[model samples]
Target: MKIRSVVLAAGLIGFSAVASASSFVGTTNAIGSILANTANALGDSTASTFGSDKVVLQAREDAASFVGSNGDLRGVNLEAALGHIRHQMPELQASDMQLAEAILAL
Candidate 1:
């Protein structure tokens, strides 16, 4: 009975972790879409007001600001940080969940 209880608890913990990761994925996707839209809008506005050259310059600056020395997203939560990070590092693996959790813990 004790063993069964332990197994059940472990299963529940796994399920909760999965659910949490799923929710984080959805939120991250939404945030990415929002950031893309914002960048697009900014580019459009800058191009319309200043000109194509200024928009190009702004894009270059943004790219530099988004990249980090380690080539990773320069923050605790990659998705949440978005434009603030020094690089564009997409969370592509399960290990990223650990990193995200660590960041949140801090």
Candidate 2:
């Protein structure tokens, strides 16, 4: 009877440890997921804001495609896009390169 009690106690202790470890792993995964989701949301918001302008939206596809194909920002499409952005949004404070890069990113 004493040996049976000892075996039962040991089994219960082992089960408890396993359960605790599983719970900890679950909590950690949940926190990681939350952090990943938050970062993705923030990135999406910034991208949307940057691309929201009609001028930027109009130029984005061409500029991005040119940059992707040419592997640089020295293309007619990119230049035209930059010029259009400048002419349309003169009040914008960003430089030509910055605008080109932004267009490429979009």
Candidate 3:
């Protein structure tokens, strides 16, 4: 087969595989709710800092909710996304709503 034909065939196979798979889905929650929950977890009303709680909360079954494979987006994306927010807009935290949409779209 010609190189072009082989590439076309592979593309078709990949497209079919992707189309056959179920789309991952999820919902969203308020960022305040999430942060408040984190605060509660830390046992400090005005701890005013995020660290282990953030990581723990992210992996939490309820906090940073999502669907599909456990490593679907990988920890890297989550970290990178948070970093982007820090440099681009510290005030803007990734809301569950946004995360849900992103998860579902994935």
**Which structure among the candidates has the greatest TM-score?**
1
lDDT tens digits, residue span 77-103, model 3: 455544543454466454543443332
- Cα displacement (Å) at residue 97, model 1: 26
- Compute each candidate's TM-score over C-alphas: 0.48, 0.43, 0.23
Higher-TM-score candidate among 1 and 2? 1
Error of 2 at 25 (Å): 0.8
* Cα shift from native, residue 15, model 2 (Å): 0.4
Local accuracy of candidate 2 as per-residue lDDT tens digits, 21-44: 999999999976854564355335
Off by over 4 Å in 3: 1-74, 100-106
Model 1 segments more than 4 A misplaced: 48-51, 54-59, 62-106
Best by lDDT: 2
Task: Rate residue 73 of model 1 by lDDT.
Answer: 41
* lDDT by residue for model 1 (12-102), tens: 9999999999999999999768555654554443334334333233334223333423235443235443322213334322233332322
Per-candidate clash tally: 4, 0, 0
- lDDT of all predictions: 0.45, 0.63, 0.44
Cα-based lDDT at residue 2, candidate 1:
100
* lDDT at position 43, candidate 3: 31
Per lDDT, what order, best first? 2, 1, 3
